[model samples]
Target chain A: AQSVAQPEDQVNVAEGNPLTVKCTYSVSGNPYLFWYVQYPNRGLQFLLKYITGDNLVKGSYGFEAEFNKSQTSFHLKKPSALVSDSALYFCAVRDRTNQAGTALIFGKGTTLSVSS
Target chain B: GAGVSQSPSNKVTEKGKDVELRCDPISGHTALYWYRQRLGQGLEFLIYFQGNSAPDKSGLPSDRFSAERTGESVSTLTIQRTQQEDSAVYLCASSLLLAGGRDTQYFGPGTRLTVL
Candidate 1:
């Protein structure tokens, strides 16, 4: 079974500083990875995805992630943080071998706090 | 007309009561999914529906949880005899296609379920 792990439960960064949220995955085959953000009482919003091409994938709200096959990691990053960017972020992975019907497995999530 | 929409933005029900959550996927989307999000937690895949075929109900937690979709448009997730553990936000998402490589899911605002 494919699984994802987010090492940190919360990450705090000042407004204008760079931020990083770590994510790792274990899957049998090539992995399709995704990042999502959820605001208070809102649904999960898609951020970015890495399928089979470039290792670096850019997403909405100035967010981006690097997919490292060797490390089995896909960490979300931003050059600078904004207070509006604070939210609950999730890392998800699905095995490419499962064709089109397999479900995505998500990490426990990491809460990002951007303080001024 | 816009994105995925869920009905009854907030639902408060007593323990042992039955609750129904509705999801209306974006028109022309061929795949629909249901997920649960507890406070401070990531998304848990609850079920997946593709077109009019039988849904992938494997992610359901127990027999008390069930879901139905008509044709390929709207979906309803039904929880029988709800418990405190069932107090979480139920999210619905839709994708234009089912192929795993390039499918991106758009989510609804979610229905917050609180069991008292």
Candidate 2:
């Protein structure tokens, strides 16, 4: 089975400051990692994904994530934060060896609070 | 590009009643998925469908929960004899294809089911 862990329940950062939301994963083989953000009462929106290649992956809304295979982490990052960046962020993983119809394993999610 | 859509954005039902939630995937998407999100929690996979192949129902929590998708289009998830524990937001997502990480899953607004 595959799984994702988001150790922090909530994250706080000041506007214009760099922010990071940590994520870790466990899978049988190579992992397909992804990040998503959710606004109040809305479904999760795709941010980015890490399939292979470069360890650093860029995503929507000026978001980026770094895939550290050795550390089993894929932490989401932003060079500058905005108050509007506050939302719930999720980390997900899919085991590459799993069948075509396998579903993503998600973490509990981290609530981001970017204060002005 | 309409993106994914779901019907009955909110639902309130009494215990022992059966409820059905609907989802319309983005056009041309061949992979669809169902997930449940309880309050203050992350997504929990329910089922997955790729094209017309048999669905992967491993994530289904119980036999009372069932889902069906027709020809890469709309889908309906039916929950029989709803329980208080069944109260949660039912989310639907679709992807163009399911080949490793290239297939990005787009999500819908989700149906908030409140079992009374």
Candidate 3:
């Protein structure tokens, strides 16, 4: 089985400050991790992914995530937050050993609020 | 090129009625996915289609939830005997069927379904 857990339901950050949304996962084998952002009343947008190689992956809108194999974590981070950056963030994963036909499992989601 | 697109951006129906939602994946995308997201939650995987065949439909909530795709292009999800609990944003995503499912999925705008 494969599962992703976003430990925070809501994260508050001031504009220009750093922000982090935590995510952890459990899988039978190595994991393929992904981050997606959803604005109000909009579909999810792909942010970044950790397939192999680099532990740090940069994504859209100045967002990035670090994949730590030892910790089983992939946490989304931003160096400077903006009010427009507020949205719902989701972490998803699929076991690398699983069949390619299988769908990715998603976390419960974290709501990020960047106040001006 | 156009990203994934879903039809009937919004649909409102009475319980017990049948509704069909459509999705058009990006051209040349070989893998398509269907997911459901309720208010304030993350995406729930419903199905995965590679080309025209669905190898995993295990995420379909019930027998009433069914979907089919045509040779890596269009897909339709038909919900029979709709219930209020089925109301949510139905999202479609498409990606290249790369090895180990390492491709980043592009998403559609999503169809918001409301069952009264």
Number of the top-ranking candidate, with TM-score as the measure: 2
Candidate 1's error at A80, in angstroms? 1.0
Better of 2 and 3 by TM-score: 2
lDDT of 2 by residue, B24-84 (tens): 9999989999999999999999999888799989889999999999989899999999999
Model 3 agreement with the true structure over A1-116: per-residue lDDT tens digits: 67899999999999999999999999999999999999988888999999889899999999999999899999999999999999999999999998774788899999999999
DockQ of each: 0.69, 0.73, 0.79
Tens-digit per-residue lDDT, B72-99, candidate 1: 8999999999999999999999988756
DockQ of model 1 vs. true complex: 0.69
lDDT of 2 by residue, A40-95 (tens): 99999999999889999999999999999999999999999999999999999988
Q: Model 2 clash pairs?
A: none
Q: TM-scores for chain B, in order?
A: 0.96, 0.97, 0.97
**Model 2 Cα displacement at B93 (Å)?**
0.4
Best-matching candidate per lDDT: 2
| Model 1 pairs whose backbones collide | none
Model 3 regions lying over 4 Å from their true place: none
| CA lDDT scores, all candidates in order | 0.92, 0.93, 0.92
Q: If the candidates were sorted by their DockQ against the true structure, best first, what order would they fall in?
A: 3, 2, 1
Off by over 4 Å in 1: none
lDDT of 2: 0.93
